[model samples]
Structures are given as C-alpha cells and as structure tokens.
Target: MVSERSSKEFFAVTLRVWRQAGPSASGRFVDYPATNVSPDMSFLELLDVVNDGLTVKDEEPIAFAHDCREGICGTCSCTINGKPHGPGHGIATCQLYMRSFKDGDTIIVEPFRARAFPLVKDLVTDRSAFDRIQQAGGFISVRTGAAPDANSIPVPKDDADLAMDAATCIGCGACVAACKNASAMLFVAAKVSHLGLMPQGQPERDKRVLAMVQAMDEAGFGNCTNQYECSAVCPKLITHDFIARMNRDYVKALFKAKFKPVSSASGGAG
Candidate 1:
C-alpha cells in the first residue's frame, strides 16, 4: 500500500536504451532513471543531462551522434518512444521538446535499425549505406566547360515545380525508418527525380536511375509497397510522385535499350 504523499515525493521516468558495445555484440535495452528533468529541455539535451549524470558516477556515457545541433544536418537521428526521428511529427529527434512529454514518461531511445544500417556502436549505426547508393550514380556527370545560359532551355512550370519538391530531401534515413519494410525508395527517388527533371541531366538520366536503384537493392533495403509513410514523416515533404517518376524513367530506359536492335545485338544487357 502506497500513500499519496509518497507518490508526490517521487516522480520517476523510465528510459529503455538499446545498448551495444560494438558491431558484433548483441544489444539489449538498459533501463535508466531520468532524474532532475526540466520540461523545457530538448530531447537530445535531456539525453545529454542523463549522460552527464552517468559520467559523474564514473559510468560510461551513452554514445550517440550529433553535430550542428541546430537540426539542419540530420546527423542526430534517433527513434524516440517508438516514433522514428522522435515524438514531434515531420521533425528530427533533436527538435523534439521534453515539454511535449509528461512528467513520468517512459521514453525508449534506439538507433534506426535495418540490415543496411548495421550497429556501429551504442546508439549509433553506420549510415554510410546511403552514401554507397548515392555514389552508384545519383548525380549527373559535370561537363568540363562553362555553364549553359539559363534561358537556353525552358522547362515547363509544372515539371520544374514538382522537381523542386523532390529536390528538398536532406538524405536523412527517416524515410527508411518510417517504412515497415525499411525501404530506401523515397530517398533514391528524390535524388533521381531531382536530377532527371533538369535539362542538364538529360545526357545520363537513364543510366543514373538504373545504377541508383541497383545500388539500393544491393544495400539490402526492402521494396516500397507504396504505403506513403515515407512522405508522411519526411521533414522536407518529398512526394511519392518522385518514386513513380523513377519507375517511368527506368521503364523508358529499358524500352529504349531493347528497341535499339543494332546495339542490342552487339552488346550484352546492361
């Protein structure tokens, strides 16, 4: 039997953290008490306070990644209390406020887990998996010459408008985390659509989409089921229309390659 006075004297916050010492090690959730918290602190700052407490006690501090804490860099990514990139919708964990939570909240902090994002350390995973996909041809090859005049090629307003929306992706893996299948379709499509829509990208647009999509599959990412969850949590609001655009470009490339009978006879399938 607990008294009301006892409850008033004690306010406890439970935190379950996914702790792993190294890449090969098995991880488990370690509980810690969130004490002396002020509701005004940002979620990452609260974690910093908890880490400070641990350091004071000669304990190992939680190893999480953060830089340019202003939230523009997307370096500080964490799934908080079961939500990818934290409690506030369409924002990173660093932007989430402790005030949005209650006095005695059960906060669960974990890294974005997927086969592609192997755990590198406690609360940090290797996100370079995304870089590999990008390197596989997410960009246009620059010509070693002066820039073409902007007015030389006029793009339709509707196409240009949609391309801008797709180009805003920050390359954050929030889309992957939000997807049930851990798909990187949203990320790949955004890059593909952004480049493919521009006139300068025409020279290598077909090859770019094929290469990036191949790389995405090789990275062990799942297929997009068109759930639209990727767009829902995207900070930049990148659209699924980009994914459709990528698909169309890929199909057009296939048809173009197949119908070129002389080249098709001389060369193996790409």
Candidate 2:
C-alpha cells in the first residue's frame, strides 16, 4: 500500500452517505465529493476526510460507528455499494480500501437495515439488541479456581476447531443486514454452537440454547428462511452449518421436555 504522505497521486470519488436525523426521521442519500483521496487510505479514512470537509463548512459531520480500524472490533460495519464490508469476502468494513474502487466511482454507504437495529443517526444503528441476546445465555457458569492445564480436559480436535470457528463471530450484525428476512439465526447459532460444543459448556447446554433463542425472538429479529444470506456477508465467514446444528438442538430439547415423566408423590398417613 502506497502512503498518501509519500505519494503525490490522489484520486477523486463520490460518496453517497445516508443521512437520518434520528430513528423516526426520514433518511436520504447525501452526495459529497471526496477529492484528492489517497488510494492507500482505508474506507473509514476516506469518510474522515469527507467529514472534515463537512465540519469546515459548518455542517454536521456524518455519524458512524468505528472502533479498532484493524477489523477485529467489528464496529466498522456499513453496507457499502450494496454489500457488507464493501466488495470483499471474509473481511470487515475497516479492511476495505479506496483502491478497491476506481477513480470517480460512486460509493453508496448505508446502515444495516433490520427491524432490531434501529437507526440512531446517519450511518449508526443501535446494535445493542445483539448485546442483550448475548447476555441471555452466551456464557458458561463455572467456579473460579487456579488455572488448569490446557490438556486437562480431553476434547476432540474437530470439536475444538469448530468451536473456535464459531467463536470467531464478532456480532457485527452484518448477517442480519444481509438476510432478506433480517434473520439473526446465523448469529445466534454461532453463539449457541460455540459454547454447546465444549465440555465446559455441557452443564448448561440445553438451557443455554433455549434461552438464547428466546432472547433473539424477543429482540424482534425475523426468522431464517434458509437463504444463507447471513453467512454470505459475515466478516468472520461463520458457516451456516451452525444454524442446522442449533435447530437440531432446539428440536431435541422440545422432544425431551415432551417425554420427561412428571414425578408424583402420595402423602401417606396424613
């Protein structure tokens, strides 16, 4: 990547930013010319330049969420050019670069469209629904004690690998945005499978899955139609396989509840 500080070459592009005053306010696309944009600059950096121009003109800068431009924080989420993370596979929005677009290209930026993710401002949405869903059952309760050896508990290599894969989900809500129904099954499934596959997670496996699914429903997210759009835009590349696994678990739990015999006691000598 060539540095703008060292290179004299700068290109121009147009940014179609979505502007919404508030959650209930009607939104519109506002075009801003980004002149002298360095090809080496990240997508967020380009926005920074545009915002600086807006600020200089005594205009409100575009409000967007970004934290760790290194692509790990998962906060730099935006629907770029009709794709999450901007025309890339297995990468977050922060990982997108200006070079990905040609000079004079028009880039459309918008927030993740979902009922659960209400618009907070221009490009920022209240994604706290994910946090609430996580809080429901995304944990394993265990006594805190001295650190145990890594191999103390025997775990199959495949299960460990799958758990790690599922754990890679950063809860960015990209899956929700990409789904036609705005389903969060992929996200919830990832969280459920990540813990359900591990030995430490065994104690609360049944309770965890049921609670998390209920929380997700209460969050106003739609149901999965098996379109697999959620997996397509996931920055972590979380597979849809977890969704099937979670469905199986949920069905099994239902059957278990239906068949469990109720205990009856008789008071003798009363």
lDDT values for all models: 0.82, 0.91
Candidate 2 per-residue lDDT over residues 73-124, each given as its tens digit: 8898799998877898888999888878878899999999989999999999
All-Cα superposition RMSD per candidate: 6.1, 3.3
Top of the candidates by lDDT: 2
lDDT value for model 2: 0.91
TM-score of decoy 2? 0.93
Q: What lDDT score goes with residue 182 in model 2?
A: 87
Best by TM-score: 2
Q: How many clashes in each structure?
A: 0, 0
Q: What lDDT is reached at residue 189 by model 2?
A: 99
Q: For model 1, what is the alpha-carbon lDDT of residue 231?
A: 86
